[model samples]
Target: MTSDKTELNDAELSRYSRQILLSDVDYDGQLTLTQSHAVIFGLGGLGSPAALYLASAGVGKLTLVDFDQVDDSNLQRQVIHREANIGQDKVASAKTNLQALNHHIEISTVATKLTEAELADLVAMADVVLDCTDNFESRFALNRQCRRHGVPLVSGAAIRWEGQLTTYDFRQAETPCYQCLYKEEQGQELTCSQNGVLAPVVGMVGSMQAIEAIKVLLTLPTLMGKLMIMDAHTMQFRTLNLPKDPDCKTCRD
Candidate 1:
């Protein structure tokens, strides 16, 4: 990790000059971002923007994991992929786009599905994890791994005209994890492929996920104990408290 007082290179100082001017993210906070390591799960709608912004913001390292490949349907909301990358693995495509955005940071790609042990290892090494996957299974697995590692997770989901964003900071003992809100056994999972989602809805949620990721990395106040809901149809937003469940199997002792 770079020291708070470490001098910034001319390009770095010029590139981040705007954010450095902000009182909240001055030199120290920006330095914190540069020292952070983020692991992003899923490279589709939510992960696309989350990964891009984190890289652009100068996160020191990013490991992108996704087993799927780009398809024509993804281009609408998956801004990181282009027509030329339609058949490429999502992580590979995302890596290309992110690398083009910022060449100073480190970017890694996991094009294959990760086994339980592999996921655990990655989560253990990450300073923060972003759960942008659409399925409940992956979310549950990632949540459990994050809890075990005591790492914070920025989770986002979008389907139809609705979107949801939240953070689970396992480092904070009382904060509720993803399992507290959605039990693993619950059925009737929804997906954009079947439910149909507005393009901008995903973009909105993903953008929020990126913002939450940065906040988590910087030790800033986050939506760790709350859920932010957005309705693209009515153009309305709401937030509600998310209390920790003492019996949560994933987070409880």
Candidate 2:
């Protein structure tokens, strides 16, 4: 396997040789993963596992954005950090772990919440964006950024063993944007913090979210324009096809 700079060492090549075995992601795709950049907003439960996998997969460049810090409560779901990192910044802790996973890649950390200023620029630079935030405000911000930049976003959410997955890139004709399904019509969403969430449930969803994100970045088939629902309680998976909304303020393009 070719390396970004130095050739992949025996262990390095053997470690990822399985992923490299796939035809779509052969040496070329591995190179693409190593040379590509992705931004993961919100380093909470979902972001934790997703970011870890992306980093371990040798995704050349990774930008982790989160404004929070590690807390005892986060340990149940946020496996990226341990109890020793309780007081440390989430981005800092995650960066350490990610780099340890693969030092060959570059890790970027933004210890701030998603803001309007310069959000579009980051989205434009990322090959794919992962939205793992818990609140509607951050989620909406990411949605608008994806729409504005025409970057594909694989969003995942898990609360209490139930999760929903969706992919959207209005750049494609007749594809639905996030707001098409959720908008000012709803009063608000029931967040996991307010309700509750299962530990492994977030990992299950977050891992799948990473899979979709990698696919989007590698230009492979993804779950675009479809919503996947996982009933962890019953271990059942269902797909809800999304239809384009002609009047969707964000996806009408």
Candidate 3:
């Protein structure tokens, strides 16, 4: 039977039939995803998998923002960039790969470091924002913008054997934001270049980030106020409640 809300052509129906079979994502939910736009910051380890899955799942538009080039070391975990893409802009490489995955999707690339104003403008244009950057400054800036624009943000981090994923539904008055759990100056940055991350660990976290983004786009229940932590050594996963900080300067308003 065809859906009254979404008119899916034969191609679209065949492409997404498996997901549509699930009770959580029927025809209407699939249409919601196909009509949504997501802006992803940082096209590295976390953003790589997130962007791939979101595009594969048929998100209509994707904006890839990153200023770095694909390095030899990135191939260890950044699956979206192949060896041939070394020295190319990460956003460019990711755009090429994502478009290949889903030809019907629209992909935009921002190959420069985004200033606060530029980032805010992009975040405001998106239905959902994914924080895949590897630094506190970018995360803080994105969090502020998401709060300001009331856009949902799916945040993920992977370092060494530890990884974490969380979602902030800013549209919900009581949801905790990224700043509520992390302080900007609490510590020096620990990038994969320094601390080193397990390859699959980032994939796991990034894949989950995509899941949260899809749920937010479809208006389904997501990890809005919870954090999922993973320890790859023991393969243990833990969920912790994230409470909104009443004194958080970013979201306390």
Which of the numbered candidates is closest to the native, going by highest TM-score? 1
Better of 1 and 3 by TM-score: 1
Candidate 3 local lDDT, 72-95, one digit each (tens):
999999999999999999999999
TM-score of 1: 0.96
Evaluate model 2: give its TM-score. 0.93
List, residue by residue over 143-187, the lDDT tens digit for candidate 1.
999999899999999999999999999889889999899998888
Ranking by lDDT: 3, 1, 2
Off by over 4 Å in 2: 1-12
Q: Candidate 2 on 221-240: residue-level lDDT in tens? A: 78887899999999999998
True-vs-predicted CA distance for residue 177, candidate 3, Å:
1.1
Pitting candidate 1 against candidate 2, the one with the higher TM-score is: 1
Ranked by TM-score from best down, the candidates are: 1, 3, 2
